[model samples]
Target chain A: MGPPTLHELFNPVLFYVLLTLGAVGVALASPRKGVSPQIIGGLVVGAAFGGVLVLLGIRGNEAGDLPNLYFYVFALIAILSGLRVITHPKPVYAAIYFILTILSSSAMYLLMQAEFMAFALIIIYAGAILITYLFVIMLATQAPSEEKVASLEGYDSTAREPLTATLAGFALLAVLTGMMAHGMSDLQDSRQVIRPSVHSLEAPILGVLPNKVIREFEQAAVFDHGIAEPTVEEVNDGFDANLRTMAFKIEDRERFDHGLETDTRFRSMLPETIHGDTVLVTLPAERGITNAEGVGFTLIAKHPMALEIAGIILLMAMLGAVVLARKQIELGEDEKAAQLRTLGQGFDDDVAHVGGGM
Target chain B: MITSLAHIAEPVTTVAPDIFGDVGVSLYHYLFVSATLFALGVIGFLTRRNMIVMFLCTEMMFQAAGLALIAFSKYHLNHSGEVFVIFVLTIAAAEAALALALVVLLFRRRETLNAEDWALLRG
Candidate 1:
């Protein structure tokens, strides 16, 4: 779309070609016997090559943005760790590498200003999920007999259909990276005048966001705790146009009732500091609220149903785990006789009755 | 767009100095990172035979998808993406619990962690 300059250094053809080479290297280097030094060497070189390609594609400047080396560093770590996760024969090592990937991606999220989700990822994925995985790996890989020492399974040492799998994976990557290279040009071209994506400062802060959970049968947290307006006006061009048609509560005294056209105008939601005919909403995230609070408020305010469903899901999972892990009951002879007697003529009780009492 | 060597020389650009680089972080950078991570996940999923490792790979893909969602949120300047990530985290936890239980049961039955060994239903 915008001259496709990524092709010059990171052109799809070259990138894919190199990626294919790297993918083949990974597949061929699959753990057989043990991870060969040559395979590790090949993998390191391949990853280093990929990193250099990304570094080459880095563009110099936009406006009001400062790109630092850490983005590149975290990105590389995520990539390399991701690669290590799949290649490592040991499941435990894979899980450890997975932790590195999560941590680095969280760093990437923090860089993008998503502070809440970043830490949440570390807590949930690295803290909870990874621990479960490590436990499972330790449990599942143990030897059944006491005499036989626990050892790696055959599948752990040998990869299944690695060549085809890597090829398929690289093909998908080629298409995606190609899209990122080609499809994102117009956005780059339009970079001369960078517009603020969200007008959080210009928008009115909701009257005071009451920090409390909504009681049952309430209009949700936004009404109970009074979450600020969703900044719909700033993000959506059509919202302001529609607001003009809707009846707004200019004078607070009238009996107010309408659909979204309720008497409460955007101005009513703002603090006393500013006055305006137009309505705008400020994000709690921008208003000095803690990052976690901002995310929780948004969750409670917007996706309360989802939060409830998540809890229900956890409950269901608990039940499912119990059902799956319960020890199987072996029926005793007397119980089997009782069960067989209840089955009537269909099942012979002779087996339970010692040679049919012949 | 004229070709300039200075872009390579200047490590930081003003796209956003505090958050991104000289030409601050764009949607494309995050997209690229996510895509690569996803491909790695997919490759692992396809090639790895250990069930636990395979599950870990799935988590990697989930992370990639979450990264993409957050990047789009930053582009749009919205909170929706982060909200979706919370749900993603929730589902992932449930999935881990169930999957781990299933893996343990299978291993108990076969005394092996290899996925292919449990394929009695192969048609």
Candidate 2:
């Protein structure tokens, strides 16, 4: 009725079949001791991935909801690399493949219009986090000396309970995906349902960031006079159609109005700025809202305490790491007594020498 | 003045479409990706005997969670989801620091990175 839901589009039986195939493939691909059929397993997994994606595509087309072709590309890369991350025998190679997974998923984030987070994922996860992983992997694993260089450690070459683990993991996946498909609705009107609250919180951020507003207005060349600084105030009484009372607080509304009156085209572009009782100054549609600005505002305004807690957690982690990793030199009981006697003798000698010199 | 000010109080119903152009990917699609990634992480964690690789699997799980958060953020047209992801990243970074340090310490003592070496002590 309302744009066909994923429940309607996705066939459960076919999905389970593909999922089971994937589980078998993963088990076969997992690192094993001798004559591991990794190539066949990889092919099987690839086949399963292809089948599931193709099924989704066909169903989506039937429902007249064309899937984003790029989603398929990024999703394939991400999942395959993710599989490699777990299946690869060598730790260094596995870490490298995980980087590939991070990169492709970040690309998906870019596709989702979350540009700030996409780049952050690349910089933080791929750049910082994966580098740490590689360092630890290298640090922990011993490279075999010249003669036996090709042989990998026993633990590195084989997986523990690969079949059982794969079975359990796929079962979990089946349940999660099945529930998501069934329980979730394609709420096309959810935007309208949530937008009012989001807008109320988002608009005040412009008030705090007056420079941003001024920059946009300057770029538009709509205002001749230097716009006055906006005064943002929190409204105490919180119940109305719009919960936040002071949605936008432009102190110099008269000048703003005069400028708007002069430029009809610009004014029309910014229809939300003019209302009966509130002088809300929102960014023009052309300028739009940047991802970083929205994320920053939400972090500071709504979840300041959480942000602070995160900082504290990081600091504690740093301290804990230093304490945990530092090599502590322990002395035997006899060694400690001897060392203390030597230290005392040395201090006495130094004092005597100083007193004689004086 | 009152008429213009009244515009400020008007509820904004249309917020996401104009900015993103169209709702291209369905919520279920991203959820599927997230679920698969998470499940793989679980399998990797359970199967891998190498301690570092096990920790790496946990990091993958964190990445999966972050992906889901971003997707939900886009779906709801809310930045709070993205904000939560930043926190998730912070927690992940913290986890990596502590876990790696413990790994290094363990490796120093036993000269091995196999998780099974510590399993008896853990029990």
Candidate 3:
């Protein structure tokens, strides 16, 4: 009824679903023969990757260790590489650069303890995509003639302006820079206090215990661990008096029974209740500590559908890439020969022209 | 000489003031690194005519972003930023795949993969 709890938001299943969606988005968006699709795919993938982490409860105060930092670094690299791939003129280099980006990103995932994701990235991107790209390049055609190279050089140097792309790239860079700067500044100002507090020292030790057990320990310390049994004021005072008398006897042992009167005041200050004794304590129900681990356990164990969806999406992408990359010859032998003849003629003419000029 | 070396080692061993506390690498350092990387990427993007070099420059930009994200994540001790990084890797992989494929196709048709030769798509 109220806003959904943090447990609901931290659902691993939800994270998987988001990841799957991102994969599908990439598959749909990647260009069949151009850089636009690849760029879009990269953006979608980056968003999905980031979204999963956010949904999986890795962000904010919940993040742990340096692995998370590496994960972020990888994602940022992926996004920038994707942008470069689409915008860059030379396609082959973009491809190689993108691969490097992916590999580094995978390393980041490995750092984050996402072993499965990291391995998958290496296998799919590096092993399959890169090899396939190389094969395609080798099978495609010969290198351009010197004339063609010269023309290309001319075009690059004196081509029509890519005004829109330049403006867009600059704008995006500015926005990203601004956001990064702002986030860094905010974090710097909201400095985390590094005081040598009990919590800081004992957190590693306490983290080993189950959340519920730890909560119980805290509650027991307050109420059941030699505290005055909660009751009406008059009833509690009598219990307190008995606890004080017991403490006085313990203190008297150290002073040969001579300091009993002197330590009576100190003894009275001791808690009234004994261990394992049930007291009529009426603790506020709302004051109970929420078990963080309990919430995480329930979310992961409860939702299996999200995981299945993510798997299916990955499979779809793999299948789609296979289909797209399947070798199919459209031209007949005669047509191929004719094309080769034309290429040969073009080559000869260029050679003859160079000879004549010399 | 040994005593002098020991004196030097004392400062080395306790370089960071415990009183000031140890936060690994300040925000300013992170910002400076990020800025330098970004500037490098921008210059490469602007000056380089080779498409591969341009992509490399873009990768540099990404590296900058990654550095920034990592710096922030470490400071915040948050895993979300890292998780976001994983998604970035996945996308980059896909982009590389398709971009390479296109490059091969372009070369087959035009016999060149140079940026200047890609006037077919312009007008």
- Docking quality tier of candidate 3? incorrect
Of the candidates numbered 1 and 3, which has the greater lDDT value?
1
Each model's interface RMSD (Å)? 11.4, 10.0, 16.6
lDDT by residue for model 3 over A26-56, one digit each (tens)?
3434333333454565577567656744443
Model 2 per-residue lDDT tens digits across residues B7-88: 2222122324433213322666777888999999999999998888898889889889998888878777677778888888
Model 2: CA > 4 A from native: A3-7, A143-152, A186-196, A199-275, A278-283, A328-358, B1-25
Question: How accurate locally is residue A161 in candidate 3, as Cα lDDT from 0 to 100?
Answer: 33
Query: Which candidate tops DockQ?
Result: 2
DockQ of each: 0.27, 0.34, 0.06
TM score of chain A per candidate: 0.64, 0.72, 0.33
Look at candidate 3 and tell me the lDDT of residue A278. 35
State model 3's lDDT. 0.42
| lDDT at residue A166 of model 1 (Cα atoms) | 78
Report the C-alpha lDDT of model 2 over A33-130, residue by residue, as the tens digit: 89898888878887887788777777666655544679888888888888888888888999999999999999988887788889988998889988
Q: Could you estimate the TM-score for every candidate?
A: 0.71, 0.77, 0.39
Candidate 2 positional error at B77, Å: 0.5
